[model samples]
Target: MDERDHASLPEGTHELSSEVSERVRSVISAAEAAANAVRHEAEQSAQVRGRIAEEEAIRIVDEAKGEADAYLAERRRRISELSDTVVERAEKIVARLDRAEEVRRQLQGLADSLGESAEELAAQLRDQPPPSVPQAAEAAPPVEQAAVAEPEAPEAPPGEEPPTGESEPPGGPEVVQLAEAPAEAGPAEAQAGDDRHEADEQLSARLVALQMAVAGGNRGDVEVHLRETFGIEDPVAILDDVFGPGTDAEKRVAWPRTGDSAA
Candidate 1:
């Protein structure tokens, strides 16, 4: 069982073992190559999947952004339109108010003219003469009593007719002389005439003003500055002041109040 047993082993056993070992090594190399190829394919597939997912995410985000931008743009447009509408309406209202203010100023000017005319008329009347007889009689009551006592006058010479008077005494001065001789008589008469002429002129002027107002026609708002500045609230009353209350000019002008103005 020593050297002879070893020498007695088959002669091809070593060669067979070497051939089997080479075949196993070749199989292992092929298997390793197949596994590497599969790994490389798996890595490529994972990379491709990642790239596709990134592209899809980018597309979705871009679409969402586009929709949001469109929505924002539409909202901005609507807001702009609303703002324009509001501005237009406000401008129109402002224009109307300006026109009303102008009208009010004009009406107030007319009222001032009327007030001036009234003042002038009042001054002229105040300057006119009062009766002279009533003042003299108070101081000359004795003369009045004498005139009453001597109702019958003594006859003058045949050539001269006696001056007979109803209210005067025989010794008293003539009433006509006292009437004309007063210092204020001349100025009072002149003032009365002047006042009458001025009143006529004022009437004519007021008529003209009323005609102009009627011709122009009242605006819708019909505000008068007199209402604010002078506290004359009624449009009709303003017209009355301008045209003279209850006069033909006032009736012809027919100035309307707020409700009638709208009509």
Candidate 2:
């Protein structure tokens, strides 16, 4: 064969050149294998990071669920406690109302008994005779004497005339006797005095009633009735001072029995 035909043929190449080409191809294959190893390592790293992030997300969701459950439990407990307190308060109020009703019934019964007793006593007293007119007239002499003694001058004193020489002493300090004129008590004043006297008599009668009640061993009940009937501010003190603690001398001085004319 010719040289050109042999050079184009696969069996006509140089043996040394073929060996060099094979060595160069082996170096290139090794470099390509190293690049493939680096790419696989990067892929493995990304997969590890994704797994870690998924685990962290799951843990966070679990923690949030636990916190929500705890909040709900606490709110339920508070609501239960408040409901129990309200029920207890309602029970206490009902109990108090029951006690108050009982007390009111007892007080009403006591007042009714006292009223019946007082009515019976008053009826019995009304059946008895009052003081005689002669006795009442006999009781008036001492009061008349007291009224006469209380006046500044005697009822029948004589009038004296002024002397002519009494005016000559005016240059010196004049002696002017300033005596208060007697009040002209018209029908209105007389009516007021009569009302005052009637009030005093009624008060005296009530004082006697209170004394009788105390002697019969019912002072507290009598005092309650007195307060209810008369609307008194201090029934006990008034009763004690008027009926029990007052002396005869103090009564005679403080509430002197005057004549009707003085009244």
Candidate 3:
């Protein structure tokens, strides 16, 4: 009821019934307790939700930190690999430079050796007399003469007997054994003739060499020929052996084949 209705009632004549007031109070108390229980339950639900949200936020933060650390590690490893690669490339370049320097040094040594050889040859040429020009009358190239081979005798008919009597034989030694042939020359004359023939051969060989040297039209021609003919390996060492001591004083240009080194 309204407050006005309660104010209009006389104090003693309008008192509420005890049983009704008791029932009303019990109902009000029960409703208040129920409302309190609902509020407490709502507060507990809000606290549980808050705790879950906080735990979830913490977990997300931890996950993000772990990912960040892994990414940094990966980047650091890649940087280290790049550094190693750069160092390796630099080392390779250095190695190549070193090899190039070594090759250049070897080339310089070769050049020096060639220069020394050329100097020696120049000295020898200065000391030695120039080769004489070949005469036009004897311009035909020298013909190397070998030992004259004896002619073989004609064979007799297959059935006929060979000439058994003293007859002029084919070879020089055989002819000397025959009675009809003149006796062989004395040892002294034969030796003199041999000496003359040897001297002529030497002169002929020297002239041919001179002709060849002139034909090539270069100072190195003779050196090349000497190396090829005598099998001299080192270009520098061959100079000493070719220009002997006191060789400049020699008048005759004798062809020397003492070691049989000539081709």
Candidate 4:
């Protein structure tokens, strides 16, 4: 071979090298594209998972909030109902006590009147004289005694006895009828108490409903409930007595009793 030929590359070597280089670049580009696609797919999957997790978290939060709201609402309802029941019972007790006081006053007046009447009757009895007893009539004189024969019953034979069939009645033994016992007063009083208890229960139920209405803070509902529960048409009347005429507003207000001095 010549020196130039020796120095030059073999036939088709450059072309082959170029073709191999192209094939290698194509393989590298394809691999790079596959890796990019895989990375993109991973990113997308991660985004989807993150979104699902966020949604799940939001759903859990919403559920918890709903449960909490329901619990709070139920708690408020129970508290309001309990408060109304207590107030109703207290008012009823106060009313009954007032009635008892009035009854006591009435009894005291009646006793006083009875005492005065008894005193007048006693004075009249003392002023009148006792009546005298009547005298007995004179006794008659006794007559002379005379002898009289005595009659005797006939005796029975030794082997026979007197017959008692004619002396005995034909019917059965006599039965005595007893009168019925008087009805007790206790049953009437118990019936009255039962009626009162049922009325109290009804009033308590109405009062609880009224309290729920008041909790809603509607002015019309408050007025209606107040009138139905307490027989007070004006809602302002409940608070109007706090500072009445001749009362000091600056004084202490948490008194133990109605007549207690706030100061």
Best lDDT goes to which candidate?
Answer: 1
Worst ten in a row by lDDT for model 3: 139-148
Model 1 clash tally, residue pairs: 0
Q: Per-residue lDDT of 1-263 in model 2, one digit per residue for the tens?
A: 68786587676366756788898898888888887888888888888888999999999999999999999999999999999998998777666666656765664566456545655554555464443222334444655565456535324446855444554444222111111111232445556765664454346336544444433424555556566554555654555554465433223212111232123
| Candidate 1 lDDT score at position 24 | 100
Full ranking by lDDT: 1, 2, 3, 4
RMSD to native for every prediction?
14.6, 20.7, 20.2, 26.9
Clashes of each: 0, 0, 0, 0
Residue-by-residue lDDT tens digits, candidate 1, 1-263: 47686577677975776799999999999999999999999999999999999999999999999999999999999999999999998788676666666776677577666656754654554565543332433445555665577656567889986675664553456643454355435567667776776555445444434434544533222224323432334445445565455554224444334334333
Worst 10 residues of 2 by lDDT: 174-183
lDDT of each: 0.60, 0.55, 0.54, 0.52
Write out the backbone clash pairs for model 3.
none
Backbone clashes (count) for model 4: 0
* Residue 97 local lDDT, model 2: 60
Residue 81 shift from truth in candidate 3, angstroms:
3.1
Better of 3 and 4 by lDDT: 3
Question: What's model 3's overall lDDT?
Answer: 0.54
Off by over 4 Å in 1: 1-13, 16-20, 23-27, 111-115, 118-147, 150-263
- Compared with the true structure, what per-residue lDDT tens digits does model 3 show for residues 1-263? 67797778777645555567888999999999999999999999999999999999999999999999999999999999999998998788666666656765665565455545544544444465533333423322221111134455689999998877467544444433442222233444556765664444333333333444323323255446545643435434333333432333222323322233212
Off by over 4 Å in 3: 1-17, 104-263
